[model samples]
Target chain A: MVHRISLVGETFVFQDLKHILASASLLRSGDELAGIAARDPVERVAAREVLANLPLRHFLTEAIVPYETDEVTRLIMDSHDEAAFTPISHMTVGQFRDWLLSYAADTSSLEKLSPGLTPEMVAAVSKLMRNQDLVSVGRKMRVVSAFRNTQGLPARLGSRLQPNHPTDDPDGISAALLDGLLLGAGDAVLGINPASDHIGRGMDILWRFDDIRQRFDMPVQSCLLTHVTNTITMIEKGAPVDLVFQSIAGSEQANSGFGISLGILSEAWQAARELNRGTVGTNVMYFETGQGSALSSGTHHGVDQQTMEVRAYAVARVYSPLLVNTVVGFIGPEYLYDGKQIIRAGLEDHFCGKLLGLPMGCDVCYTNHAETDQDDMDTLMMLLTAAGVNFLIAVPGGDDVMLSYQSLSYHDILTLRSVFGVRPAPEFEAWLERMALVDGTRLRMNQPYALPNFRAGS
Target chain B: MSQLAQDPWGPLRRYTHARIGLPRTGDSIAGSEVRALQAAHACARRAVHACLDPAKLAVGDSFIEVRSQAKDRSEFVRRPDLGRRLDGPSIALLKQIAPAGPWDVVLVAADGLSAVAVERQAPPLQNAVRAALAHTWRIAPLVVAHNARVALGDEIGALLGVRCVVMMIGERPGLSVSDSLSLYMTWNPHVGRQDSERNCISNIHARGLSTGEGCHKLCWLLKSARKLGYTGVALKDESTNMTLLPETKTP
Candidate 1:
């Protein structure tokens, strides 16, 4: 169905729902590169106006990617909650936006509406909203999930201490992990992006994280960013697989490009939960996503990057993920282009993920070539924190040596915690207190550092 | 880098290349740290936009130069699909230089994201491959693709009707290592093949995967892929456990 709208005496027509979604996106290079962006700024606004009038149920009836071909579309259509949708059943996308902002839609109301909302519906409504609107609404909804400690609590910001090593060196990773842990980070988890694809290396790193957590008796878990299949294989080898991690995308073809499927993820998920490693709760999956991934893999299906990105949240929410992060700038300047575009995509991703009732975090990051710098990251980190982002990925100096990108550093995590008056997850805070790392909720800057067995042991 | 003041955390730099424990003034890293980071970014940014000097790229080497469908660097960065295929003239050039039937493998080098990596690393890797496979396999002429991505190899190989394609391209330039190269090998070389259908060996640099070690794995993969009739997920590089090379630096 071609949607038409006249703006300032010029008529703009979008060929289909996907076209409307694509053209209405906050100007991103990925859409333009996909050749689906609006002809001009006027058409963008025109498309947004058309999208705002469409009822939320229209998304349920019309899928951007056909349900016959894509399992992700099938998941979205088949899993939508009709009962939860009844309150805003008659509302247009614009009305839904107002409802999101209204006093009636608090945390509980948003929770009730979470399963009712599909990615397409949320992506459509987001096009009509600005950065502040996205933040204001997203800040209201809290998506609490847990494993060793609770995440997504209000007035709390969890963080993953990403102690990545270029060569998966035990001493190197141990040193980075030691630094991050000393700064009172890693309340979310201690994760690493191993340089080698060999499962032995991934398993070796996992052992190191597990050993660190066990020896310190810290309220944290361990994860290695390897393939889901590798994690499943590790599980068979009796490796301590705390959270099964994978990079997911919007399309079936894109997921295929990663050599993963819903079935494969399910197998890994089952294997992880069967380990029964959680001390507090049982949310076992951790997923990382980014916009333009589908486009990068040549499986975008003409959908805009942001919409494609929001679709991944639908997939994440299905598995009851403990953590879902969007590596906002890691795809580089090709998709996002500059700091302005990266910042916009970051806010949109966080807001949309929260709306889906998934524990949303942002990898407030940029590539060196992406026309963004540390200052832009600092700005995005501050904004995302205020928007009630569940967590943030904090590497040692925001420089991820293994991944070849800059992310929010461990020091940035300290800044966010201090500036926003937020603390790490409660159980982790208690653990830090026992270690004399905290002085009444504030991290002690001058503590005597002693991890004698860190570099050499286990 | 102030004349009198030095980085207090300098001793901790031994374990990793990651910049950690940077000194902060007021929620921001010190200006010295920022400048150090800027220097790294400057080189990386230059690597992204740097043009491949053909004379320097092919020194005492007869490289059949070609260009991707992307007209220039800007289009090459944005339009990945265009960079994956050859231009009209490039296609014509490849067709003219090749035989009708299949060869064992075709090799193509590309200045992908980092011209420094290609100019510095690809020649030695090419020599190593030629030395390893000259007697065993029917190799095609080395093609130098400008403004290219990994899949450009498939197009050149398909035009030559080769069994496999070895794409040597620049990996994205990181701060610590700007001139790292990557190798991608695909059997049944053709258009529209997924990245999952190929095997990759990235981070070929002085500090990372050594040239000798890279060749060892490549020979093993080429032999296995030919026997197995594929090169992706089904094939795994277990070269580390095998005692083939005299000294192997396990990544």
Candidate 2:
């Protein structure tokens, strides 16, 4: 006989009884129980009575069966007694498994469930799920949303400007900026990594990008990829700073190598908050992380790369950053030797970061020395797009000369949109349409436009 | 350096290229400090995108200039595989130059991430190593390969039938020093050898390892490698013991 028992608040004795009945062939599978639950009132009541009357256990063999043996399940039950996730934790493994399958079938339930759910609880439940189930769950949990200027992200796939020139020359910088914008890129942020450690040059680059952004009337934010202290100094100097950037490692020692502490990060966040430069609301920090950074900085603390990465997310979550991206394949071949390892790390970082309630993106990139190519990047990009990545770094042609690596390009953004039917952030899309760069959700670049006359030849 | 302008942290900055203590004015950085950082940043950027000019490198006409399979700087940055081997015509040229029995060593200079590094640091370092090893080794013609990576030396060495290959390539540009070159020496050089199979000597620049010191270290390692018949992790640098003697002292 099939029965859908409401397992909530059921004692251990009752669970033991249910298991004993199942083992003795008295009970059917969860699907059958769900079917019985769908039946008329009389059949459902009869099925419940049959389940309740079953013998608790056969004591003659002295075989002891325990439901709390699985550590993950026990932890879930103990931690999830609060109102938000209690219903999920109280479910039997079979029932929870069935619910997970149903949830995967229709992920719109995630928006309904997200309010009460913490990423930790989601992570706990995820331990019982399969790979496909994790993907579906990851695709639905839009915990953090970013709005740069007027462009709201994670509502659509957003792209960042990575115009890395060797010198922070205004003319050279302007050319790359115009090129990227002409190809319909950088809706997320205009980010630059200066080769110089000078606070003034970094500030100059920030001011230049902001000026160009204003001239074009583009609703984009500008970031200078410098140390947090330098960014703070620039803000004090009255430089137009939108977002502060830092590379964070997992362990304490590694972060120390970057001259950062949790205290310092909080200070930077506070500094940016006080400036309040952007049109968008606060959350004006950007962080980039990767595997092997901890080990490289002599601060791994004997932790594995993936765990260290997740711990790094906890640090990132503190800032409520507008963006937190993992440069998956950029570390080198030593840690992630090939494309296969790179792809796996990207998905894991994305899934874990999303679970931790961070706006996650993946810089699908690789150094030339590694055994990876454009095809590998495409595979990771498509999977990340499917997994609902918030943003990606968009360079001119996938070649970053200054950084000495390859990343996503303008064409890659278009490819993701055409292949996955993903659009730019809603506001950015409207801007694209207004500029006639796209037609009814389709990106179209029939002609190259001339550079604006405001700063002609600089 | 003015006493007033000196960093309060003292000589700590001298030991590393990383930016550390700087003199400050009130709550802001001093003007001189800002300009110094700007200068360093400009140099690094110039090195990252600079092209190699064989004539300016002035390693002499005996060195045959060759191009890797990568057609340009952008292609070289994007496709690392192309930078690790010679083009078909360049391969034919290598065959024409040295067609037979293995020589003791083949030295190559490649413009890696920083062409300025190769141009500035490679000549003095290469000359010192050659002068030291002139008696013991039959070295092949010096190869100046444009748009090449470290592994490109392996193919050149294999085609020329050399016992070992040493490539002096530009290291990635750091904000503190853009013109830093690195040496990678591989024993029994051939294609498909992993990076772990090579021994590296890094930070060969004005502020780091001087050309004379770099040559001494390179010569000691090369001789030890020739004796041990390998150059990777198996061969450790015992050159420190050699430098302990008074006669081998570096100035």
Clashing pairs in 1: none
Summarize candidate 1's per-residue lDDT along A325-387 as a digit string, tens digits: 999999887899888999999999999999888999989999866877888988899899999
> Residue A392 CA error for candidate 1 (Å)?
0.2
Candidate 2 structure quality by residue, lDDT tens digits, B190-235: 9988788899998888777776777778888998998888889988
What DockQ, on C-alphas, does every prediction get? 0.37, 0.03
At residue B123, candidate 2 shows an lDDT of 79
Chain B TM-score of every predicted model: 0.89, 0.85
**Candidate 1 vs. truth: CA RMSD?**
4.4
Q: Write the per-residue lDDT of candidate 2 for residues A1-458, one digit (tens) a residue.
A: 23234334332222332232222221111212112111333333333343334321221111121224422222223333244444453554335445656745244454444333432323233333445665665686675555454332444788897877766665555556655665677877888888788987887777777777677677778888889999889988999888889998665667788898878888989988888665656779899998667655546544345545665776787678888889998886546656876877787778767766678888999765455667798898988888888888877556665676668876678778878887777667777777787667655542324334534134
Which candidate number would show the highest TM-score if scored against the true structure? 1
Fraction of native contacts, model 2: 0.00
User: How many Å off is the CA of B219 in candidate 2?
Assistant: 14
Most lDDT-accurate candidate: 1
